[model samples]
Target: MLVVRVVPVGRARLVGAAVRRRLVPALTGSAPTASILTTPARCNSQLAADAHRRRHKNVITGPDAVALRLHRGHLVVQHPRWPVDDAFFSLAWLRDHCRCRHCYDNSTFQRKTDVRQLSSVGNPLHFNVNSTGTVLEIIWHDGHQSEYSMRWLWENSYVGARHREQRQSRLWQRCLWDGRRTSAEDLTSVVYDSFMTTEEGVRRLMKGFLTHGAAVVTGVAPTPAATQAVVERVGVVQHTMFGGVWEFTADGRHADTAYGRDELLPHTDGTYYSEPPGVQVFHCLAHHGHGGETTLVDGFAALNSLHQADPAAYELLSRVPCAGEYRDPSRRLHMVGDGPVIAHRAGAEPTPDSLLRLRFNPYDRAAARRGEPAEVEAFYGAYGRLTELLWDARRRLRLKLRPGTVILIDNWRVLHGRASFTGRRHMCGAYMARSDVLSRARSVGLLI
Candidate 1:
């Protein structure tokens, strides 16, 4: 006959001992199993005593011993009587204070409470295992207590899976800023004579280009010649039917044309081209107009709103790639890209991939139609939603372009258009390929 002894430890020790005692008789299958030699009453009494010992040995006095070590940021705990690994301590604390409202109802919104404000406190209020050790609770400075279960804490604490999905649904893009003030006396000479003529200016310009996806250069003359000066310095000027020279006329007939429309909503220009120029340069030749305010909205903001409103719709748009086309008797071009009206890269901090062109000109859509029903529906749905957000006046920043100001935008990052013009307004605009800027800047050692 063989006898086995099992020692209980932590919460599972008692259960393990009970299982061992019950298995011995079942395995032997003798007349009364191994306990036949002893009286039934004595055997029953012995079993009860063993159960009591096991329960008492496993009893935890104050908050689970494992939880205490974690709050202290201790790497290891070895009291011999109660030994616990770092994972046991670390994971226990996380399980308790999951930013989710189920554990901490600090706000109606389930966003994690800001920890930045707590930096001033040496050791701010934190949730921990209660003194009784049976349940976990938050120990507030005011002496309030909120108990939470281990299972609930664990479930909400590790939200990496959900976070990954969020990142995938955002769009990422850049904006540009030149930081050159208009007040300088020799703004052009300051720009031309300085390193801007050398390598440093090129680098600074490229840095702004990469940062904001657009930039402005002051002191440059807002003339066709000045436009050429910029084109010569950076990249090839992007040309369009309304390129090189642009007019801001109140003539109703001129307004009917694409270039003449006043009070224009936010829209990416040149959606009609198969490959819209990657960047746009507008030199303000004139701006005496009263209401022709140039409004700019961070397309990134619009994309985020769409994502939060309808994640499923957003996902569909991102996955389905579509073609945008524009055509006239003389020229026809199409743009091919993947993403929803607002698409984002997949990561922890999601950003917009592109500020999808959203103004729905039926005439343009009709020309671009390749005859796919599902794709068409998806495009219209995303386009409509994006247009609604862009036109929301509150989100925009209205700025009037004064004469001699040059605004360069990453065609992909910005959607430039005009408000109604009450008075006189004239502006010259040009498009420049992004590649041209990169190549020229590199030649000048501005870009590495």
Candidate 2:
């Protein structure tokens, strides 16, 4: 007799659905006859004993093995490790997802055949849970075989409780850090050469950047390419019309004052773009100066304090959109956008969402907003309060970036500025997308 089987590879599993088939001549007393009738799933005691020999790497004994059971037409898994149990998948899903060599193409990781055409009569003839209880082997009415791993089952397990867990994870708010408390030691900095050359260094730097929305790497080449190299360690450097990794000097010709020798305020760049830049990088190439320090303010940290002090003010700023404009006469370029001074989830009530980006550029900010008289007044009041909190001396961290120093900022979350300089201070920098930064983190298993 010819039998076909599909099974999961390694440690992934599934369980779920309907079936059909034909009865053999010996059973039908005639030539092969089709039978569309559905039948109950039967457990196989012999195959179950044989499957016991193949142990799963992550299995536990005793009560843990009791975590799995057949309920009606479904395979129910009760794992104490995670809060939720997977009791949703049917036998059909388990059968259809078989990853056996005949059923799946291992090289391309693609399914060889469709499962939807399986007859309703295709119920399991027998099933076995291995010693680790992580794998389940099954035999179907048509003599089809399958092996499923518990890890795959749990990863795909989705139910009402799963959504609740998702919401809980999303509500995480970063702890506020100010100058006095969060110093170079707290935020931590990686050596530039090591970060570019080693996996451990890249992971360490990524950890700090992901955790704080900013990080520092020292001992670079003090050049534009050096800044690009730091960013490229994780992902490619994103280019804009401003060009890739351009140098910033007092004498360089550019539309923005960032090219000139002026002290900038704590603000996020690229608010003028519809889709603002995600991550911004800066490298100090030469520093023969007195005051070219970089300033960073934790915008979310500021919002937390503001939320505690004044709910009305916080709500107003989070609701009202402010204006940002960048105009270059030489290039005949004009860019503008209006968004919340403090970006967050948009709703009538104030519930802090994960992303709390700040866009406070006094120089780039347009004139006072025009709106409903009362709403506009409340917005201005909230704006003033937030500015006061952001500019507070204690809240800002000032770092004198020397040559060979690179600072990376999350343009969406952290606000940055420059301390005025007198002598020649040249800086080179680049910008990268937020997605690439995060993709590299996942690629290295730093994030899942």
lDDT of 1 by residue, 1-448 (tens): 4333333333422111111111121112322222101111112234345433543233222232231222232112211122223223332343334454544667664545355533332211333333322234443333334465433433333323344334433322243212132121212222544424666665566656655555666677767787677656676666665555454455542313444544676666554455456677777677664677676655555666777886655565565544444444333433333222333434423334434433222223334434357677766687667668656766665566777666666675556667776655666667776577667655754332
lDDT of 2 by residue, 88-176 (tens): 55766676678898788889999975765543524466555543334657776678888766556555444334554465345332456
Clashes of each: 27, 22
Q: List the lowest-lDDT window of 10 residues for candidate 2.
A: 18-27
TM accuracy, model 1: 0.48
Per-model TM-score on C-alpha atoms: 0.48, 0.69
The lowest-lDDT stretch of 10 consecutive residues in candidate 1 is 33-42
lDDT of 1: 0.47
Once fitted onto the true fold, the runs of candidate 1 whose alpha carbons sit more than 4 angstroms away are: 1-196, 243-258, 319-364, 371-379, 440-448
